[model samples]
Each structure stands twice: as C-alpha cells, then as structure tokens.
Target chain A: LAKTTQPISMDSYEGQEVNITCSHNNIATNDYITWYQQFPSQGPRFIIQGYKTKVTNEVASLFIPADRKSSTLSLPRVSLSDTAVYYCLVVPHSSASKIIFGSGTRLSIRP
Target chain B: GAGVSQSPRYKVAKRGQDVALRCDPISGHVSLFWYQQALGQGPEFLTYFQNEAQLDKSGLPSDRFFAERPEGSVSTLKIQRTQQEDSAVYLCASSLGAGQVNTEAFFGQGTRLTVV
Candidate 1:
C-alpha cells in the first residue's frame, strides 16, 4: 500500500482555481493516482484518475509527474458547493487490492 | 437500485447489542466494499467481496465484525457485542469490474451508527 500525504486544510475564494497536491514518496510502479471528493454526511465521489502526465475531467484535473511520487488535483472556478474533503489515493493494478484512505485535505471555498 | 444503497441511514445501538448493516450494490457490479469512517477521518476499509466470494477481510478490526455476501448481490455486515468504539459511519461501495481496473467506485450515503 502507498501512503499519501496532503495538507490538512485549505481556504480559497470563489471563482478561483485551487490546486491540492498529494505526496506519495514510496509509490509503486503499478500504482495509479486517483482523487475523490467527499462531503459531510456522504461518501466520497471520484473526481479524476491518471497514470502519468495529466488527465482532465469535467469536475477536476489530475496531474502526475514522471517520477509518480506526487500528484495534483486542480479545480477550476471553484464555487461554494465545491467545499469538501479531498482524498488522494494510489491504487495498485491488482484484482483484489485494498484501498487505504488517509486523513484527507479539507477544502473550503469562500465568497 | 440505481446506485449503491444502504439501509437504515441512521442506526443507534446500545453497548453489548448486535447490529447488522445492509448494502445493495448496483445491478451488475462485481466488486463490493465496506468501510468504517470516523467523525474526523477518512474511511477505513473493513471488508471486500468479489461476487459471492470474500477475497479480503484483513481490514476488519476484531472477531466481532463479520460480513457476508451470499448470492453475490446484497451484503450484510454484522457486528456482535458492539462496543462504543464501533460508533462510526459504515460506508458501502461498488465498482463495475475487478480492483485491477481503473473504474470508479460508487458509494452510498452510509449508515451512521451511534452506540450509546
């Protein structure tokens, strides 16, 4: 399992782009970087996933460097509803691999 | 149903009692997972099922916690002799294919278990 480290919390203004970075110094070769957003009283939802370079989706963008040790999640023009806890996970390419969630970064969007 | 559904959105159990949580995954999903989430922390994996076979259960905290997915659709997580430490939100998730794929796992709202 690959352990991820991220900021505990972050505050940003509305209509601004926010980028959250996660560090996985011991990432495995077969691991894929994935990001999820979780709100209070609800389960985490997938935002974006990538193996290397950059992957973009409607909700967020995931960028992974060649070293694969770290990744960044970018949210464009964040709104108040975008406030939630963001988790960065490194999942291996195995049939029965387990997903370990760390203490996620709480993102707060303000007006 | 449409997405992953967990019954009894909220549950309050007393100490020494047994509680059973239910999870109904998507119609054709192949992977189902159970997780325990504390108030200020991310979800911790409890168990996993690939169809009717339980492939991984190492994340279960103690012997009191048991989960089964008979017939390969719905799953039940039963905790015997519940303790106060067992009070947390139990989450259920399902994915279309096996864990090797990059598919997204759809999660339910979860059952908030409060042991008093």
Candidate 2:
C-alpha cells in the first residue's frame, strides 16, 4: 500500500471552495487514488476516484497530475454539512487488496 | 436489504469475555471487508472475504480474533478474551465486484464495542 500524507485539519466557511491535497510519493503504477468522506458516527462515503488526469462527479473533482505522485480533491460551494474527515487512499489493482486508512484530513466548516 | 447492515450497534463487554459481531452485506455483493476504527483515528483493515473464501486475514490483531463467512452472505467476527484495547468500532463493507474493478464498496453503520 502507498502511504499518503495530508493536512491534519482545515477550516473553511460556507459557500467557499475547499481543496485538499494528498501526497503519495511512492505510488505504484497499478494503484488508483480514491477519496472518501466520513462524518461523525458514520461510515466513510466514497467521494471521488481517479487514476490520472481529472475526474469529476456531482459531488467533487479529483485532479491527478501527470506524475501521479499527488492528487487533489476539490469541493465547490461547500456548506456546513461538508464538515467531515476526508481520507485519501491508494489501492492496488488486485482482486483481494485491503484498504489501509491513515489519519485523514479533518475539514471543519464554520458558519 | 438496501445497504450493508450490522447487528448490535453498541456492545459493552467485560475483559476476558468473548463477543461476536455480525455483518450483513448487500445482496449479490462479492467482496466483504472488516475494519477496526479507534476513536479519533482512521479505520484499519481487519480481514477480507471473497464469496465464501477467507482471502486475507493478515490484519487480525491477535489470535483471539477470528472471522468467518459461511455460505458467502453473512459474516461474523469473534473475539475471545477481549481486552480494553479491543474497544473500538467494527465496520463491515461490501462491494459488487472484485477489488480490481471500479466498483464502490458500501459500508454499514458499524458496531461500537466498549470493553470495560
């Protein structure tokens, strides 16, 4: 598994755009970058996933540079409900690979 | 039925006791996973099951921990001689296909275990 490093915590206000970056210097060629959001007392929800370039969904956008050494999760027009712990995981393309979640970046949304 | 479900949302156990946690994955899901999450920390992998086979169990913390997925639908995690360090949330997740695919894994609310 590739180890990921992210900010311990971040603060933002309502209606603002929040960008969280994750650094995975030793990412493997077969690894894929995935982002998950976990609210208090709940399971982590999949936010977005991208192998390279950019991938966008209704909720967020993932930008992977050409080197694929890092990725960024961009959330547009964030609200108070966006407050949660975000995890960046690099998983191998294997049938039985397990996910190892590290201490994620906690995003606190202020009113 | 609609999503992954876990039983005994909260459990309080005494040290040296045994406990069982159950997980019900989504219908037709081929991959099931178990994870342990401590307070203020990210979830750690415990085990993985592909259909009725236990593909991986390397993440099991100790010999006291055991997990089984009989018949491939429902699964149970058993811990013998539980200790205070065993107190944490046990989460279960299921995906429609193998991990090599682009499938998303859905997670249950998880069972919060407290060892006193």
Candidate 3:
C-alpha cells in the first residue's frame, strides 16, 4: 500500500482555481493516483484519476509527475458547494489486498 | 437500486450493544468495501470482499467487527460489544471489478453509528 500526504486544510475564495497536491514518496510502479471529494454526511465522490501526466474531467483535473511520486488535483472556478474534504489515494492496479486513505485536505470555498 | 444503498442511515446503540449495518451493492458489482470514518479524519478501510469470498480483512480493527457478503451482493457489518470508539460513519462502496479500468467505486450515503 502507498501512503499519501496532503494538507490538512485550505481556504480559497470563490471563482478562484484551487490546486491541492498529494505526496506519495514511496509510490509503487503500478500505482494510479485517484482523488475523491466528500461532503458532510455523504460518501466520497470520485473527482479525477490518473496514471501519469494530466487527466481532466468535468469536475476536476489530476496531474501526475513523471517520477510518479506526487500528484495534484485541480478544481476550476470553485463555488461554495465545492467545499468538502478531498482525499488522494495511490492504488496499485494489480493489488486486491487493500486501499487506504490519508487524513485528506479539507477545502473551504468562501464567497 | 441504481447505486449502493445502506440501511438505517443513522443508528444509535448503547455501549456493549451489538449493531448490524447493511449494504446493498449496485446490481452486479463484484467488489464491495467497508470503511469507517471518524469526525475529522479520512475514512479507514475495514474490510473488502470479492464476490462471495472475503479477500482482505486485515483492516478490521478487532475481532468484535465482522462482515459478511453471502451470495456476493448484499453485505452486513456487525460490531459486537460496541465501545465509544466505535462511533463513526460506516461507508459502503461497490465497483464493477478490481481491474485497471473501472476501478472507481460508487459509494453509498453511509450509516452513521453512535455508541452512547
């Protein structure tokens, strides 16, 4: 299992782009970077996932460096509703054993 | 249902009581997982099942916690002799399979368990 480290909390103004990075120094070769967002009283929703380079989706974008040791999740023009706890996970494609989550970054969007 | 569903969205149990949370996976999903989330912490993995077989359970905190997925669709997580530390949100998720593609897991709203 690859452990991820992210900021405990962040505050950003509305209409501003927010970028949160996650560090996985011991990431495995087969690991894929995945991000999820969780609102209060709800389960985590998938934001974006990527293996390397950049991957964009309707909600967020995931960027992974060539070394595969770090990844970033970017949300554009965020609104107050985007305020939630975001988690970054490194999952090995071939591993069926377990998937773990870090403390996660609590993003607060202020208007 | 259209997605994963968990029963008794909120449960309050007395200390030392036994509680059971149910999870109904999406139709035909092969991978089911359970996670426990504290107040301000990220979700911690509890157990996982591939079909009817429990492939991983090392994440279970103790023997008091047991999960079963009979028939490979619905799952139940039972915690006996619950303690105050067992208070948390129990989340259930299901995915198509553990393959590279479609590895994303669809999660249910989760069951909030409070032990008093």
Candidate 4:
C-alpha cells in the first residue's frame, strides 16, 4: 500500500482554479494515482486518474510529473457547490487492492 | 443503468445488537468494496470482494465486522455486537473488475449507522 500526503484544507473564491497536490514518495511501480471528491452525506465521486504525465476529464485534470511520486488535481472555475473533501489514493490493479484514505483536503469554495 | 445502491440509508441500532448493511452493485460489476467513514473523516477500507470471492479483508477493524457477496451482485456488511465505536457511515462501491488498473468505482449514498 502507498501512503499519500496532502493539505488538510484550502480556501478559494468562486471562479478560482484550485489545485491540490498529493505526495506519495514511496509509490509503487504498479500504482496509479486517483482522486475523488466527497460532498456531505454522499459517497465520494471519482474526479480523475493518471499513471504519468497528465490526464484530463470533464470535471478535473490530473498532472503527474516525471517522477510519479507526486500528482496534482486541478478543479477549474470552482463554484460554491464544489466545496467538499478531496482524497488522493494510490491503488494497484490486481486482487482487489485496498485503498487507504488519508485525512483529505477540505476545499471551501466561497461565493 | 443503475449505479451502486445501498439500502436503509440510515440505520439505528442499539449496542450489542447486530445490524446488516446492504449494497447492490451495478448489474454485472465484478468488484464490490465496503468502507467505513466516520464523521469528518475520509472513508477507510473495510473489505473487498471480487465476484463472489472475498480476496482482501485486512482493513476490517475486528472480528465483529463481516461482509459477504453470495452471488457477486449484492453484498451485505454485518456488524455483530455493535459498539458505539461502530457508529459511522458504511459505504459500498463497485467497479468493473479487479483486473484493470484504472477502473473507476461507482459509490452509493452510504448507510449511516448509529449505535445508541
């Protein structure tokens, strides 16, 4: 299992782009970086995932540098409804690998 | 057309009683997972099932927690002799299969368990 470290909280005004970085210094070769967003009373929703370089989706973009030890999740033009806890996970692809969730970054989008 | 669905969105159980939380994964999904999330904390993995076989349970806290997916479609997480410590939101998620590295998990509105 790979442990991830991220900021505890962040604040941004509406229309601002918020980027949360996660560090997984001991990431395994087979691990893939994934991010999820969780709103109150709801389960976490997948945002974006990347193996290396960059991956973009409708909701967010994931940027992974050459080293693969760190990744950033970018939320564009965030709105008040975008306020939620964001989790970064490093997961393997086989045998029902377990995902360990750290204390996620609490994102607050101001109006 | 359905995503994962958890039943009895809220469950209130007395201490020492047993409670069963159900999870219905998307039709034909081959992987199902159960997690426990406390208030103000991200979810912690509880168990994982591939098809009808439980492959990993290292994250389950204690012997009181058990989960089973009989036919590989619906899973049930049962907590025996529930304690106040067991009070937390129980979440279930399903994915295409355990083979793909980037398979996205679809999560259900978790079952909030309260032990009083």
The candidate that wins on DockQ is 1
lDDT of each: 0.94, 0.94, 0.90, 0.91
lDDT of 2 by residue, B32-102 (tens): 99999999999999999999899999999999999999999999999999999999999999998878347
Taking the tens digit of each residue's C-alpha lDDT, what string does model 1 give over A1-111? 889999999999999999999999999888998888999999999888889999998898888989999999999999999999999998888998778889999999999
lDDT of 2: 0.94
lDDT at residue B88 of model 1 (Cα atoms)? 98
The DockQ of each candidate is 0.83, 0.79, 0.65, 0.76
Please give the TM-score that candidate 1 achieves against the real structure.
0.99
Model 3 residue B102 CA deviation in Å: 3.7
Which candidate would rank higher by DockQ, 2 or 3?
A: 2
Q: What lDDT tens digits, residue by residue, belong to model 3 across residues A1-111?
A: 788999999999999999999999999887788898999999998777889999998898888889988998999999999999999998777736566888999999999
Ranking by DockQ: 1, 2, 4, 3
Kindly list the per-residue Cα lDDT of model 2 for residues A12-92, writing each as its tens digit.
999999999999999999999999999999988888888999999999999999999999999999999999999999988
State, as a TM-score between 0 and 1, how close model 3 is to the true structure: 0.97
**Number of clashing pairs per prediction, in order:** 0, 0, 0, 0
Candidate structures ordered by lDDT, highest first = 2, 1, 4, 3
Which 10-residue window in model 4 chain A sums to the lowest lDDT? A92-101
On residues A10-57, what C-alpha lDDT tens digit does candidate 4 reach at each position? 999999999999999999898899898999999998888889999998
Model 2 achieves a DockQ score of 0.79
Give i-RMS (Å) per prediction: 1.0, 1.1, 1.9, 1.5
TM-score of 2: 0.99
* Cα error of candidate 1 at position B114, Å: 0.7
